[model samples]
Target: MRAVRDFASGIVHEVNNILGVIIGNAHLAKKSSANAEALEKYMGEVRDAAEEGRELMRHVAVLAGEQSSRARPLSLNDLVINVTSELDPPPELDLSSEEATVQLDVWMAREALAGVVQFMAETKAVTSLRVATRVVGSAAALTIEDDGASPTDDELRALFAPFTKLDGRPKVGLQLTSLADLASRSRGYVTAGPREPHGLRIVLTLPVSDGTPSGDRPGVPLSKKGV
Candidate 1:
């Protein structure tokens, strides 16, 4: 019941934001019709917001199980490179020199990682970021460390739960909650903790795969812990 509410709430929150952008820009475009450059800019904003809403709905479909997972053999290095390349002012990367492959849905993996990265970069007062990928035991792991405001232990736990309030306002840390869902779907898990001295550390681990049964390949169970 809480999960259902949280899911619905997140969808509502995000949709409302997108709608605000669309509506605001549409109004601006109407008033700026006489000014070619300004009108073009407003219309472009509306188009981009609409496109974002469309993508959000697609992601919701996947979360609701209306879409199916499309797991395939993929190189972890390639996946990291492709996803990070799409982010503006992308994080500083320290990928392992060796190749590590994992079986997972590419879209889910990409979105989950991108969402986390973007959230931290935009809202967490993060000045620098370190994204590293490697093989830990039989799991392909991604560790994202950021020089950002350090959350307390309780705050770290709250990050993975929707609708947690901070500073007397609702925080849409739903990105991490969404991440938990996507990780579970990928047979992986996510953990977050305070980094030494300052900052935050988030680790996401998925089972390493070679198209064989992963029973023998130690997997990262759904749990949270320190880095």
Candidate 2:
């Protein structure tokens, strides 16, 4: 299937790119005349690149495993805060929420949310990655938005499909396609689109806790702009 091919392509592309960085650094190290400063610089680059590759592989492996069986009713808003805080993300990250408690495998749900937060953090042009949640009927929608990284309609169509580096940007990374897969396994759905005025937006919908939706609300804190 096209989906399978795309997933394969994405994984290969990202791995190759990281390997390229390591190789380039090795070449520089070989030519550095044994100078401590030059060797240190080259070694540092190699180490950093290798670490990134390691993290990617670890996360990919986590995603590769069977979905977590520990499903429960919990507040997604709280999950976002907990995960992002652990990341020490940019100060510009504005996380808000109304009430959005959904039934999900917390571990897998955390992984999916981490993918979104990590991708946004990597976008140098992004001013801020804003997150919010709202409840409607028996479902809760968590919207993650950015003030940068706008994609074309065509790009948007393939956003959750697979492939890396769309339009010269990290379109997916272990992107939405993986998140979609994880969400589906946990009985949820995810979608993407351009936000109003400009920017990228992703909304993940899941069944609400207790099958009864809470009222809609935005980030209530003025300081961090969180719920």
Best by TM-score: 2
Give the C-alpha miss distance for residue 177 in model 2, angstroms. Answer: 2.8
Question: Candidate 2: TM-score?
Answer: 0.77
lDDT of 2 by residue, 178-224 (tens): 67876787688888888777778888888878743222222322111
Ten-residue stretch with the least lDDT total in model 1: 218-227
RMSD in Å for all candidates: 7.7, 6.2
For lDDT, the strongest prediction is 1
lDDT of 1 by residue, 1-227 (tens): 87678767877887999999999999999999999999999999999999888867765665667333567766766766666676567789898776677886666666677777777766546678788999877888888888777777677767777545433222544567667877787788989887877787888888888763222122322121111
Off by over 4 Å in 2: 86-99, 121-125, 211-227
**How many backbone overlaps does candidate 2 show?**
0
- Displacement of residue 7 (Cα, Å) in model 2 is 2.1
TM-score of 1: 0.72
